[model samples]
Target: MARRGTLALGRHLARRRLLQLGVLTAAAASLTTEAWSSTSTTAAPRFSEYPFSLGVASGDPAPDGMVLWTRLAPEPLAEDGLGGMPNRPVPVQFEVAEDDNFRRVVRRGTVVARPELAHSVHVELHGLRPGREYFYRFRVGRVESPVGRTRTLPPTGAPVGMLTLAFASCQRWSEGFYTAYRHMAEEDVDLVFHLGDYIYEDPINPTSNARQQTVPDYFQVEAITLPRYRTQYALYKMDPDLQAAHAAHPWVVTIDDHDVDDSWAADVPKENSPTPTREEWLARRAAAFQAFYEHQPVRLVSKPSGPDMQLYRRFAYGDLAEFSVLDTRQFRSDQACGDGRVIGCEDRLDPTRTMLGEEQERWLLDGLARSRAQWNVLAQQVFFCQRDFEEGPEQRFGMDEWSGYEPARARVIEGFRRTSNPVVLTGDVHVHAAAEVKSDFNDPTSETLAVEFATTSISSGGDGADVTPATLIRLKENPHLKFENQQRGYAVCTVTRRSWRTDFKILPYVVTPGAPISVRASYVTEAGRPGLQEA
Candidate 1:
């Protein structure tokens, strides 16, 4: 391991050497070009190469509007996060159409692409009809971006037939090919929810056993600054399959620990780490949030203010379902007992310990009680249900998950009981899981109040197997866990007035490309039921 680490460090230094030359060249050219850009008479940059390399995306769907996003990057891997744009703002025209051919154009407008935000545009489109699909595209003079498809959520307090939504999380670029997203692009889902770990902060090491070094010297060092964070998003977004997924469906997203720093809970970071002070960490967090908003289709209302961003919000899909997306980081309490899996830890059982924080917890509970939809889905990152890793005399639990916070979990479970049909959609575990939310997890006879469906990773853990040793052990120990699988894929949810069904979509291999997709299992919950029942 030491030898591999040294070799990786050597490669990174070589990459930095190459980037220095490019940076110097860019710096020399920018001195002249940027000065021209400072004047009001400045025009667009001279682009001999295609600038729409990052592609276009639409997300944060509402009843009448959605957020459209894009960035111009003629040179993607330029070391600088400027995306090869001028210093001044550029005019970008966007249009939304009822049809793919734009014969029935509905809305058209122009927005400025500012250099302050890496020349990215987030056009929050409004005044459109609900429960309808729309095609949108961007243009800059003669150059045109690829057309993207998006849809608004169904009308509230209305009886909708059904909703087909796809959700997944944890897509590490080095793990495997994003062939799962390639398949998801072809799926007929109305919406997609990405529950964080959007990008990993660790340096890429090819000799690592977990995943192959797919893109080496690609921002190889850990991301701490704004430029590094922005560049990371650019690198990940370069995948055609990911771009296809974004173009295909509107997405609702929230970050996990990996988005900023790994295993970082609330204000406190992991024990024995290199982050010097809280101020520095907040700066790192601020950089991460700015880059996230700049690239994603998230709503403008949730924009970051320094170190914080209001990501936890609610969206209704008519009377069929309502999604309450939560942010597990930021205001959350630090993981009890100094993080990681622990057996018999007293800190984890503290009543004051919280996973959703006080404010978000209140908001979520109130939203669940007030929702008119038949299904109230708590969409967020990390596992919500309790899971004991070991069997018999000793009980081991992960502090990173809800299992560590007993009081918080109990309150959330009680809140679900107050709703019509509550369901928790989770990620960050890197494996598929279906479980029953017990009022009292220790008591076998305790009431099952709600249900949870933990979605698997996209390509984070490489080509995962259908049945792994960890899955078998966990299932044997925990009876409430109905199903689980270690596979590289996403989850397809079909919600209706009668029932909420989840299809565990699995791709056995994502090491190369074009792995055959299949449904590993199907589970359902009746309109008023809370526990899992095989469909």
Candidate 2:
């Protein structure tokens, strides 16, 4: 009779556990359905799958540490709309090694992936030696993440020899494969810089075949909610090439307009539209910002809170390079017109109007002046060229860019001139271009202050646009512009004590998968000679 009772109790406990699993599965199913419809191809696959949809990444490396990130979502979409992951914290272990073999282990730790934060984990490792390369990977239970290689910035005041850095932006996943990232991964770069537009907020509309489409829109056509934002990021993070690139090196990231919305100016609600209120927009922005942080390998300083994330920061690579990353979307005045057209829009040209805000601008200028590094790299978004629309006196089109904010642009140029060691690295405009930055674009003989290299999009709008002629016309009008290529790819920059060489790689096409990539052009800026020259 005692043995019979023991067996009965064991059966009862088994039944209870089965009931719990049933409840959890039901809850996940409900959430998935509510979050997204199965009709959309972009809708995440059902939960309980292999190789988690969103890949893993690491970013924002300091002298002794870097941040590792990944999300846990077995079911991205369910009826209840909660992303299908159990609402429980899961333990994740991180291991870093000097070699890929995991033989010489250097750093190891464990962190909890809390479901309240979407089951994402961000482990910031510290106390490691400086200027060393390390391979790292994360694990939860029996599942292991892809192995990634990252390096810490060299110790301050250390005399560094040479550094290779690549910067690119504007990756619309559906538009094309991540050929740029594929190429970037193959390059032996020490660091990668993403200047923004990491993802587009707009849904893929069939009417506009201008950009490629990997998956259909999972959110509503008009606006995005928290779940929608999270799902979008999850979809983007699934790209293998992008994952490979992230696994290759630490990325320094800053957001551009499309990360929130197209042509979004500071604190300005959508023009002539009856949509969500300012508070609603703030909530949406907050959600988008949080999702971005959760997905990228950024540090804790950039954590999101209701549209408030301190994104502008600096990264120094010993005495070789100092990167001043900026935030241009948060504190600027509204665009002159809703369309980002209309130059000298009184509000745009206001001396008080700023792209980096007053505090950030001061910080940047101070950093530039005090920087002891051989190269001062300004990692920013948007074009720095005076991209005026007309070549001659016939007509001048006013578009949103550095040209729209003459006074603010002038201030940045003056700052570069004052420091005399600045190199402005920018993205956006979805086209590749390089220029000899001058204090004045209207004056051909104006003093050249520094140099600017603007990388094109990863896949946004495919390769060359039909406006190539107009682009060439504008280029011819501005003598400061050294070269321009309307292509899809990235710029690989090699910096040495004597010179900086930029190789602009162009992908054959973006609409089709597996597009071939080639070196479209190359430019070099020698020390003491600040302007760009054909390489």
Candidate 3:
């Protein structure tokens, strides 16, 4: 284990050195020019299989434009993790139009997909009309990829009537089918927010796995290297349902613990028995972040720099809504009281202990204070309101969630008071929860500062039940918690100037290939009113 850690650290340091020397940049430039100059590459490179097998996507929409993404994965599940691409860079062309047929071509450009970046293309575009829907596609040789739909956000502070969106998270491919995503793709929404656990880093057991799809033997081991992480992403991206969700709408994403490792904290590995050093963990984090960026339809600004990636960002849908997407796992202090569920952990209430770190906290608070939007949305992971696991006077809470960082949670609650209608869209917990964020958790009658709708998982657990004994206990303990459901699904939200309504879309079963979806519960909060009411 020590030897492996040392080797991983060595590889990471070597890459850092090359980056500092600008060798990687210079080599990439030379390769790109050479690739473009090659007669075969410039003309039409032939391929045995369709290159865009993983499908196309767009995300991070602004008033002007959005980021377009596609990976040239002729053999998506190839163990090598290069997506069966050649060693050289490949030129990928993209086109955006007002219609799906491309009759009204608006933007056309070419980008180089280098082997070092897993033959992925992220085309950041601009100069587009605000609040307009556009259709985009990619071309390689004579093959044209699937046409994807994307919409630009309304002009900043512009009066908009309504904004429709769906938020989902925690889709463990090996555990269950991605049937919820198929339903989500069919929803008429302007945006989709993925609040983390995009890919599980744990090893797979196909024989026992719910999906029972054939996979490489190497997938039985945890993802630690760049190639391993890339391969894991490839496996997940190969799902048609997931691809449909990405193609159907633009997504705003943030990372959670499962994206890298199960319950991993900043610079701290969850497995401490054969504990990895900080350097080793950072190296692993870098690999995970790189794979995440390569796979997602995110902008270049989110590209990982070693272990760090700047993912926390804000988006405005005119003056109607403002989204404060947060990265809770990246810069957080290690879980207090040694992590996990606990009680009487004094370390949790420490004023200096933070969940967003000092910088992101300041940014969130500042953005909340300065925002003019009618709805201030915190698109994030984990339960934002107090969730007491223990039923009676014990007062047990999850150390890994906001409940463990009471002071930090309190500060954010104060920020919620500054906004018109603060709504928190959360994931991470497998069960759906609708709660009213109170100014004081100890007193139920205290002012309700905001409302939270924590969506259930896409498939993480097998087929979940509608309710369990644990669910009843949780509701009994937390009076502010209005509802709870243990079903695999997502949340569809419609935001207007007057009110915000969230419908919890649930799937009865995800163990099989197809499952019908239904709205199990619905909650709405009015403008200038923070608490949730049955819709």
Candidate 4:
């Protein structure tokens, strides 16, 4: 009866998660300001080092408020991944003020940072005004965290004349410095979208690191255990530039292949040495997901329940735009044709293959149909459009992304018709590109269904050249692909009622500490139009 009751409870939770589409409205995320019962207020505990080493962040913003995140990490690189915190819950205080100086305090609260969650705090707030900027910080005893800036979305269906945002992905710490993020921190954007590969799971070589920084021996092995994953996140989060970017804007994030493993699909792990059994893989996945949640600014709704976590959700920014952030990795079928670049593979065309599971696909289409926003955006990982690798009649495509799931790609393209203007923002290709989503890739003149702006990496491929020989060939092969550049950078978009303009921001070098950023190219899609044009 206990097992049956647990099964029933799991079914109930699944139903609840399925019903939650636009989580901003569906999830009751607000946390009470009352002190947590577990928190002790007798005396403030002291640490030998600063507790806010990992820094503060806010994300998943709504009209009323956003989730404020901070982890107490005095000894950030502790092997146990506990951040040197004692095995108990510590009382943490939070303050939301209208100004950075805390002169106009709006909301205040006390929450407990539990050792189970690596002494992390996610303060979900509400009752604040819409379409306004707010400053927030965490306090542990007399030590206060750095002031982080965040903003709430405008009211639902409210008239928003303009919205500016930046999207970035694929920052491998050992490869290069976070110079792009340092520049991104200065951008006057309202939001930031991190389309995954946030942390590379592979082992980092201390001697061969591009940044010439000292890496601990713990990172010499792949992050498989809970503590290893936590330490990996700490290493990435320890970057001041990354912290600055997080502090500057409210980020909406989703993971890709590197967040877990290379080209892992559904319950399947990638082919490699010392392959683990299915059960072991799930445990590793749970650890990775848990560590991801503890470090990110995502809400409680995103907390992982074992190997599964509810990550795919929608967010609306007034009547101007709506974003449907996707989780392509968690629910996708195993890659077809052996999961690599392949030609003449009929398995890719199998109608049963799915990029997003049937449920998420349904949710996406339904959301598109019901959306009243002027611009509907699919902020997701992986390339959405087709790309033929070799410049010849015999075409080969990467099997890991949408190109491998042809039927599923077609269905999503068909769903684009439900909205007025459809735009796809993609990552993980490590090359900046602007492509028109054609109804049929075989024919170059096929009607444009949507436009895709794929941003380059933050620092994944170090010191990328401008327009490599392969890039030129790819652009020539795929005419639908307008522009392609092998550079480390991000894409910034300015959305208005009339048009949405994207600036491909590029950095010359990331191996070095400071590199100047510039716009490589700019594309604009006018309202009611679905193709890209020079801005």
- Cα TM-score per model: 0.90, 0.87, 0.92, 0.92
Cα lDDT for residue 245, candidate 1: 78
Question: Which runs in model 3 stand beyond 4 Å of their true positions?
Answer: 1-44, 273-275
| Model 2 C-alpha lDDT per residue in residues 81-127, reported as the tens digit of each score | 24577666666666787765566787776787776678788888889
- Candidate 1 lDDT over residue span 1-535, tens digit each: 4864574464344323322322112222222221111223235666655667787788988889999998977776567788778788888777787766566889887788898988889999889999887877766654567667788887777788778889999999878888898788777778999999989877766355243544546566788888888888888888778877787778898999999888997767666545758887888888889989888888888788888899999989888888899998888788888678999889887999888899999999999888888889999888987788886768999988988888888888888877988899999999988998888877757888888999899988888788877788888878789999998899999887888899999997987888889999999988876789988
Instruction: Give all candidates' CA lDDT scores.
Output: 0.81, 0.73, 0.85, 0.87
Ranking by lDDT: 4, 3, 1, 2
Q: Which pairs clash inside model 1?
A: none
Candidate 4 Cα RMSD (Å): 10.6
Arrange candidates by TM-score, descending.
4, 3, 1, 2
Model 3: lowest-lDDT 10 consecutive positions: 27-36
lDDT of 3 by residue, 289-354 (tens): 999999998999999999999999999999999999998988888889876889889999998888
Question: Model 4: how far is 231 from its true place, Å?
Answer: 0.4
What would the per-residue lDDT of candidate 4 be over residues 420-499, giving only the tens digit for each residue? 79999999999999999999988999999899999999999898988888998889889999988898999999999999
RMSD of every prediction:
10.4, 12.7, 11.3, 10.6
Model 2 whole-model lDDT (C-alpha atoms) = 0.73
